[model samples]
Target: MQSWQKVQCGVLLSISIAVMAGCSASSPYRDRAEDYRHAEPSHYELPPIPGQRDQMPIPQGSTQGYTGDEFIAPRPESMQTGVAERPPVELRKDNQGPWLWVNTGPAKVWPALQRFAEEKNLDVVYTNPRSGELMVRADVGGTPAQRFSLRQGVGRQTSEVRIVSMSSGQALPFSEFDRERMMALEQYLLVTQQQQNGRVSLAAQNLDDGDQVRWVDRDGRRLLVLDFAFDRSWGELQNLLSNGFDEDAQRLDDQDRSQGIFYIHYLARAERDSGFWSWLFGSDNADKAKAYRLVLTPSGDMTELHVEDASGQPADIQVEQELLDWIRRQLT
Candidate 1:
């Protein structure tokens, strides 16, 4: 009976093993796991989102691509050459003196001022177009007749007429009378008759349009060259920042005239957007404004201006050019 029991146990154990092997061979989870590991996406394509487009393929040898990148570059330097449109004629004053900035060259300004003196019935004491100076005797309010000086050809195709009141050979302060005289001349120059007259003064032809502010390229880097002493250059730039440019106000963050560094916040007109959405959101211009350092170095009598970042590090070439151009336009 014991032998029969052992044979029966062996048969039962073999049958149990066969049943377990059959269950393992037909297991659903075992086969499904392999399919899950090797699964791929469906063949159908989804519609693209509105206002979205696929990025272009990168160039073969390019190490990086800017497409689809949020980075906006500085406006490229204007390649269009030739004289830019002259700034509108305006009246400017500073510690030096009040002067009328005429947009035309000395040739036109000299003749126009001569006509002004004649029309006003003012006594002309001296006239030297070559030196860009004209002295006229005019009464200032109740004061005696003072010597008014009109200087032409101050900058590039520009003129400055300054009235100097000399009492006992001592220069007096410019009064409202002087300003009225300048305003009259400014209006005279703007008239279509005067501008279309084409009467170029032969004597003033020799008057040097003392181009005090200009651009120069040195060692492959562009610079704004001010043909003046360091002290004078500093004063000129300071006056510009103080007076501000056209519609945009120039902000002078910090300045060290002795060290020849001016830290300023600058915004280029090209970077500005006039769209309705841009104005409503105030997003475009706020991000475009940047701070830059203007470094001045004396080169003989001339002062050289170079643009750098706010930290004094070299700025991007395009940004430097734009800043320099802005300075040149204002100073000139």
Candidate 2:
């Protein structure tokens, strides 16, 4: 009877221990937390230090000053938000005919034209990506059928798109309807986004007839050769001279279309020599003004531009080169 009583007492002690453990687990840190009631409320929310019970104090001059303030992250420079700029598209006409001048390669324009045809519900009768040409018949909805000839431009990364009405296998003259269609294409190109694939068609690139301008050396002198005829070259040069050429501003002095010569005065930015007294006393660097003559010579199909001094003699080598380079840039 004594041993059984001892066993019962041991079981009772185990139960009491378990009850106390459960009560402490329910509010493990209640007593310790009440001891620190006077401390700041934020102190209790800080991350505890590794192997340490105490939390670290907030550093002086920290972001704590921005408490209760709304923050906005800045946008990165590479991440553009607004509508991006589209490729350049222009409808141009010359003595040849009306054509669209798009500042892009034929490869890109080929796909764009296909997409346009699909969107307009036009029937693509034929497509020759090698020749950079697409023959589409837009006769649907009582619209007159037309054919277009797309070709690579003489300049790099440019295309010349031409259109005409077709009837009985004969192409008609460019009409108002053709112009309207061309304008729509131009607008489409202007607004639509283009990819930067840097694609080039070998055959289409070969279709580029020739360069508009070229530089050649003949008889110990450099010449700016234009692939255009003399009349066209003259008209182009006149237009360029009428407008300004560069930031320094080259002005026309005299011109004689009969003689195919233009005299222009060029002033470097340093030679401008503008000052408070310049208007009254003239510029001290007025003597630095350089005058050059642009002489056009017809060579079969090409026109050559020869730079000469003010007196009509051979221009200084360095000055002639610089003038030739500037004129080439303007022409191209």
Candidate 3:
């Protein structure tokens, strides 16, 4: 009995020790809860209600009454000065094409061209503003002749003056006189367009036409004009030539966009079919690839493209035309 009592006492002591250890472990959480419960409120204040004063006192003086009409501020001095300092309208000429483009519409250009004819002392044979056409007759070097056509260009806000010389009511081919007359008219109209200012007419802003490629004659040479920036035109030409040549036989040999030159390889079809061994062993009959150079020149807002052989000689007219036609189709 004595031994069992002793054992029971020992068990009770162990239980009390374990409970004390557990309480010590959980004391931190109880301390945290008590700290939160005793914390003071924050110091923030709510905003005052609109249209109701809480602290400010009313003024003692009499307030002014509102006028029936609202006060309107005057226009800024800068705006008035800007109107006086406005720059004159300037026209841009296409180097390859016989046309000029302006920001104003055809209505403005029509009157300007008419005024030009009057100033030149040319007889206005016919004038049609609706169709954007004008004809003027003048005597040049003792021969009575008429300018065949002076018309608005296909693009919006663009106009062209065709200087086709006519004698005895027959239209002649483009001549040196025609070229000089065209240049003179262009200069006169450019100056005239700059001086005039009025209400601009409403016309379709045909932005897409700015990118279309066209063929034009410049100094008796047929040149291809692309209405694109130089960088964009260069990239398009690279892709066009890359995909245009025979895939397996021909490839782009080299290109320099800054210099506006592209070198292309034209390998014979038979060379492509020959085995790798033939190429490695230097077969006597293996055909060599021919190289061609493409040159691009920027003319105002347009880029002109021309082709030549490896020897730096201009490509045959038919060859150049055919290549340009193919590129036009691809671009379209």
lDDT of each: 0.68, 0.69, 0.58
Q: How badly does each model clash, as a count of residue pairs?
A: 0, 0, 0
TM-score of model number 3: 0.33
Off by over 4 Å in 2: 1-87, 138-145, 166-171, 193-212, 227-248, 252-265, 268-303, 308-316, 329-332
* TM-score for each candidate, following the candidate numbering: 0.58, 0.53, 0.33
Model 2 lDDT per residue over 1-332, tens place: 99999999999999999999999989757766666767766545678677874476775773421335574442222232111332488666655457787777676677677677889877888877777667777564655677767766545556768787777777777788888888888887666534444445555655555457888877778888887678767766765565553323356778988889998776544335665797687774535668888899988887889988889899866557666766676445
Runs of candidate 1 with Cα error greater than 4 angstroms are 1-88, 138-155, 192-195, 210-212, 217-221, 229-262, 266-285, 295-301, 329-332
What would the per-residue lDDT of candidate 1 be over residues 1-332, giving only the tens digit for each residue?
99999999999999999999999998886666568778888798899788886588665773222345466675554453223444546666656666666666777677877887788788788888877666655455555355544444335766666667666667777777667766776677678234477888888877544667887777667888887778657766765665553222236777886798887776664566655786686554545668888899999988889988877778766567666876786666
Model with the higher lDDT, candidate 1 or 2: 2
Task: Look at candidate 3 and tell me the lDDT of residue 230.
Answer: 79
Better of 2 and 3 by lDDT: 2
Q: Extract clashing residue pairs from model 2.
A: none
Off by over 4 Å in 3: 1-104, 138-141, 148-155, 199-332
Candidate 3, run of 10 with poorest lDDT: 78-87
